[model samples]
Target: MAADTTPPALQDFLTWRLHRLAKLTDRQSSDAYTQVFALGVGEARCLAAIGQFAPLSVKDLAAQANLDKAQASRAAQMLVDRELVLKSASETDARGVVLTLTRSGRPLWKRVMRLIEQRNADIFGCLTKAEQRQLEAVFDRLIAHADARPQGSSPATP
Candidate 1:
């Protein structure tokens, strides 16, 4: 048995796993929405965020998406151009706009959500309910850890 102490191995593992999960989910959704739209994951994500929590400002959307505000603003503009989303000048603030999923967006929202639910169910079916809960608890712990860290630091690396 050779030395097995690898520094930052856990950190590297966590980063790889996180990115892998994102890629897998995006691939599935890419297949799900294959022919109906011309949106990339970023665009679809912005739409999904607005679809779930509409009437939010671009700033709020950025916070929710963990995206740059300028990027969110541009994504929202593209969505608007496609008529998949609607944005209105804010009544409360002169420098803000509020966004909502449009009528044409309703079906797309439903479709994406259905795909998400199905994939979630499929993934969860591999474990017992208790195991599922444990997995979720582990994820919650990591989330709390990330929440507590300084903006750009990772626990295992820091």
Candidate 2:
């Protein structure tokens, strides 16, 4: 048979498209946060997670922020160095610690949250309300499916 001339449909791949979207979204947020708060993406995520879920452990922040333990720890330390988050021993777990926004951090968190809301609206503005809802539902399903899979398992495998 003659050599196949068709190009790979990367644009049509769900994973590829989602990855592209994520990168775009992250870059936009990163730029905005850095401009306003002098924070990198990981640091901003950790800050937001801590602000939104105060009195939570670092492990919980890592899980909520979708960051690994090391990354989360680094971010937490940075936040502490900046005095934006307060770290203290966990009341429930003697060996564990919890994080919460400092007085200064609360106002910053509010501003960041407002910016995020605007950014999300701008990003999803192209879609209709129904389409947005549909997309969110689909994303929920995709997230659940991916999260339920065994780590390192090939998608093509059982």
Best by the TM-score measure:
2
lDDT tens per residue, model 1, 41-158: 5677788789899888999999776679988999889889989889999999998999999999878877767766777787578899899999999999998987888997755854
Q: For candidate 2, write residues 1-158 as lDDT tens digits.
A: 99999988989987899899999999999999899889988988888899888887989999988899999999999998999999999989999999999999888888888888889999999999999999999989988998999988975755
**Candidate 1 runs further than 4 Å off:** 1-12, 152-158
Q: Give the TM-score of candidate 1.
A: 0.76
C-alpha lDDT of candidate 2 relative to the true structure: 0.91
Ten contiguous residues with the weakest lDDT in model 1: 32-41
The candidate that achieves the highest lDDT relative to the unseen native structure:
2
Error of 1 at 12 (Å): 6.9
Q: For each candidate in turn, give its C-alpha RMSD to the true structure in angstroms.
A: 3.5, 2.4
